[model samples]
Target: MPFVDLETNLPASRFSEDFLKKLASTTAAALGKPVDRMVVLVKPDLPLFIFGSSAPCVVLSVAGIGVTDTAEKNRDNSATIFPFLTKELGLSEDRIVIRFSPLEPWQVGKNGTVVTFL
Candidate 1:
């Protein structure tokens, strides 16, 4: 599973209901994971400041098993996501920050149990 949490100072009205689905799809495709297994949480209107200003900045965190384990893969993922974020959220490149967390299967829980995908 790939979990993407997006926290932004922008208002919720900035996003359409379908935005999450599109984002989940984009992230899953970028990571070569199943879209159904991707979870995207958008927390808008949060008090997030960048460079001492709260001018529509975003803090996006991504966690997944095997998807974010390498530097090259992370770069590739950033290459894919950066444009999407800028175009979709209308945010400048410098206004967004993304953190990737690589996780082991055992560290995740599903269906009241722990499992491995590989």
Candidate 2:
């Protein structure tokens, strides 16, 4: 399972839905998983502040199996995601913090069954 959840103080309308679609494809390529299996979520319009500043701060949590295996992988994923945020969200690169989390196979359930695909 690959999930990219974004929590931002900015307006939801400021983002492009197409970015999630593209992120699904890019994340699939990075994880060697099928694009259909990815889950992308966006929770904007939240009351968030970073470093005591309410300007525009985005906290991104990217969870997946076999995707965040190393720091190098995290850096690579950041490279892949950063440009998109700059272009779509119009935020500076330094305003975002991306965290990578491990997603175990047994944690996912689909269609009344637990599926294990790592």
Candidate 3:
């Protein structure tokens, strides 16, 4: 499973109903994971600042087991995600930060148990 959390200073009006679904799909494709197992959260209209400005900015965190296990894999994932965010949000690449967390199976829980058990 892949989990994606997006926190943005932009308003909710900036997003369509399908935005999260599309993001989840893109992230799943980028990570080579199943979209059905993706969990995505989006928090918009939050107080965020970048370079001391309250402009539109996003902190996107993606986590999964083995998906971001290497620098090269992270770079490859960012290559796909960064541009998609820029185009969809109408923000500059510099205004968005994508953090990739390589998680261990034991660190994640699912179906009332640890992922390692699944």
Q: Pick the candidate with the highest TM-score.
A: 3
The residue-by-residue lDDT of candidate 2 on 17-90, one tens digit each, is 67778867776776677989888888989998886688998998888877887999888888888877777778
lDDT, residue 67, model 2: 85
lDDT of 3 by residue, 7-104 (tens): 99898887776998899999999999988999999999999987778888999999999998899999999999998999899999989999999999
lDDT of each: 0.90, 0.81, 0.92
Q: Residue 113, candidate 3: how far off, in angstroms?
A: 0.8
Model 1 off-target regions past 4 Å?
none
Q: What local lDDT does model 1 show for residue 21?
A: 88
The worst-scoring run of ten residues by lDDT in candidate 1 lies at 109-118
Ten residues in a row with the worst lDDT in model 2? Answer: 109-118
User: Using lDDT as the measure, which candidate wins?
Assistant: 3
TM-score of 2: 0.86
Pairs in clash, predicted candidate 2: none
Candidate 3 deviant stretches above 4 angstroms: none
Give the winner by lDDT: 1 or 2.
1
Q: Give the least accurate 10-residue stretch of model 3, judged by summed lDDT.
A: 12-21
User: lDDT of candidate 2?
Assistant: 0.81
Query: Residue 2 deviation, candidate 1, in Å?
Result: 0.4
